[model samples]
Target: MSFLKKLKEKISKQTDTVTEKFKHGLEKTRNSFADKVNDLVYRYRKVDEDFFEELEEILIGADVGVSTVMELIDQLKEEVQRRNIQDPKEVQAVISEKLVGIYKGDSEFSNEINMQEDQLTVVLFVGVNGVGKTTTIGKLAHKFKSEGKSVLLAAGDTFRAGAIEQLEVWGDRVGVEVIKQGSGSDPAAVMYDAVQAAKARKVDVLLCDTAGRLQNKVNLMKELEKVKRVIEREVPGAPHEVLLVIDATTGQNGLSQAKTFREATNVTGIVLTKLDGTAKGGIVLAIRNEMDVPVKFVGLGEQMDDLQQFDPEQYVYGLFANLVETEEV
Candidate 1:
């Protein structure tokens, strides 16, 4: 009846490959974060004030966000008093349980992409440059294509030099057509063209790429507003998903970018890239708890198929795979 046991049973029903990916991708965080917790538990056999303080520091070190760490620590204290727990080892499962709880909270948000039942599904990708925005789009296009859905790419990043060609390269690699205009052309115009082409070709999904310039917030907001306006006018309820891509390696700076984009446009979901490359995977919790926006997908590895839909259970399992497998019910 332990929380870890329940998690093991729940994860057992899912695909083993996915679980393994989570385990492997989270190795860095586990080695840095979970391993430290294991050491803390070993060094302090009894749960006490000092023990909780050290644990708080560990959670904060993992980039769990200061406020969230405080909240989690307070909950742990209440749970300890309520259950009269004395062993530090017994707190591991509670930590895992609380992490999943914090991510889910009271909301019933679904992480799935919002695809149209019988019409073209438009997904707009937004992020500052060098955050792997283009690559995420390519990977997503590949994902949709692998699902037997006809996909199209709209090169709306006309402001950046070679942005169109970059998207085209991905288009060719994925064997999908790219709708683009010449460099320095208006991005809104490119979107207009892409929308028309997607409708004409009747593609199942259209992934639109936009300029990632954050040099001026006013310009960024104006440009995104214009692009969104064109899409809405062309196809009602279009641009169904505006996914903000962030590099996990950047840590807190990534969260800052999320806030900026959320202000400029309505970011429906987040696509966290380079998750395997960071030791602070705890940013996932900070984003969800603080921003209230769901992380729809995460880049677990460098492989094309490593971009996966976010699952809180699998994520916690990944963070404590070693301990979860060895713990007794």
Candidate 2:
């Protein structure tokens, strides 16, 4: 088969079964977003000013950022004019292509964790307390362990009561060792110890959970800096990935949280949690468009395997499965 055909087949297979996580996780978004688009196309058979206006509304309402919506609309206009298309229904495919393009802007798309080949890879988790930060760390540990890599968890979230215990619980569940200190201890100290232990044991990955206190950005920044310094001091060029976890159900508020967290530290990627719980999955587009950070992982369900790497093709197919089928027909 030709490369394009093969690629489409792969994406189709993924949407059919391989990407059931995204398909099921994005069910709410598919229903709401697809319904709105289908309705709009049905209402306006001809592409006109009103169609563009309604399309903008739908995109914005789907939690696509205003800036992203504007850019998309502009691109849509250009595509429509360039293609000389008149049917709004025919524009659906173009819209999907554009949406995916927005996320891929100028750079290669990737969801892979940047792990060191021959050394310990440290991932520092950061976000506000209630955004599933600890849970993400645990889930990631499980994933890394399942991959046959020696994984360790560092309970560096010393500020929250029971934070250390929670990470330890996850460590126990995943059959990995957890390095921790008492609650309210210096988070940097925990990181220091974790790095030393990881190096000593020849661990493959070290997942660190840090305090989620974001009320005071200055304090949080300082604390994170100290932790980062300690990790680098122990192992130069450590903390391979600083992942920012966000609750997908938070809608646009999640975007706001991302902006704040990015300002506080260098966030390499995003982990969107609770994706199955919200109808505002369009926030994914807004996130990549506005924040320019790749979404590393998405939480689809409560199962250990629900946290899958983000795939743009699968995501687009999942979101617009019905629309794509209709277009093919």
Candidate 3:
């Protein structure tokens, strides 16, 4: 089949049993929001003033951000005028295409695991609670191991209850060894241990799981900086990547999280969770457009395979594909 069709089928196969979890969350997104837009479409046969007003609200509400939404609406308006469009469904298609144009215009994002020079590559995951940080680590480790690499996990999320065990759970699921220090333990101490172990054992990748801080941004930044410093002291440029994981379902709040984390630590990339959800999926653009961070991964389901590298072209197209679906609620 076609590339897009093949990808959709693959995602369908992987998420078939649990796509509802994806559908349920996405169906509730406030952007290009369903309630009013669907209602407006059913009411009017063609483009009108009220539709644009409501469409603007839907995009803004879904966390597309005001500026981006304005640009999107303006483009849609131009399309309406140029094509002399009259159908609501057709207009929806136009909206989707414009969104696809946002991030995937010319560049394609690489999702492959990159190797380092002398030692194994190390990635440190950072994010707030409930952003799927631990789960992403497990999935990423599985991804690397699938590529014929020795992987080890360091559970440094010692502050939260069951955080270390949670990482262990992933390690167990993936059949990889987990180096962990217990809860209330020094996070830096855990990283030091993980670093030293990875060096001697010569694992391909070392993933450090950190606690999700509900505290102030400075405190969080300081805590992450300490972890990096400790790892560097032990392994020297040890943590090769600092990835910030965000829940896409959280919408614009995800962008704010990126900003804070970027300031706190050098967030080299982002992993967007809950992409299957209906949160407009526009936050991906907002992240790239505003913060200039390349989105590395996107979580589409609960399974390990659900977390895949963020392909701007495929994702940009997929986000709007639902708009063209014949099925209607």
lDDT by residue for model 1 (1-329), tens:
77877897899999999999999998999999999999999899799999999999999888888888998999999998899999999898889999999999888866899999989999999999988998999999999999999999999999887889988888988899999989999999999999999999888999999999888999999999999999999999989999999999898899899999999999999999999999999999999988999999999998989999999999999998888767753
Clashes of each: 0, 0, 4
> How do all models score by TM-score?
0.98, 0.95, 0.80
**lDDT-based ranking:** 1, 2, 3
Model 1 clash pairs? none
In the range 1-329, model 2's lDDT, one tens digit per residue, is: 32223335777654355567777888899899878998999899799999999989888888988999999999999999999999887787788888878888987778999989899999999998898998899899889988899998999988888888888888889999999888888999989999999999999999999998878889998998999999988888988999999999999999999999898889999999998898888898899989889999999989998898998877777788766556556
Ranked by TM-score, top first? 1, 2, 3
Q: Per-model C-alpha lDDT, please?
A: 0.92, 0.87, 0.76
Mind sharing the TM-score for model 1?
0.98
Question: Residue-wise lDDT of candidate 3 within 1-329, one digit each (tens)?
Answer: 33334445555655444444444434445234655566667778678888899888877766778877787889889988998988875675566567656665455544554569667788999999888899999998898889888999999888888888888889999989999876788888988899889989988899989988957777787889899999888877767788999988888888888998888888888899887665567688788767767888878877777786666545533544454343432
Using lDDT as the measure, which candidate wins? 1
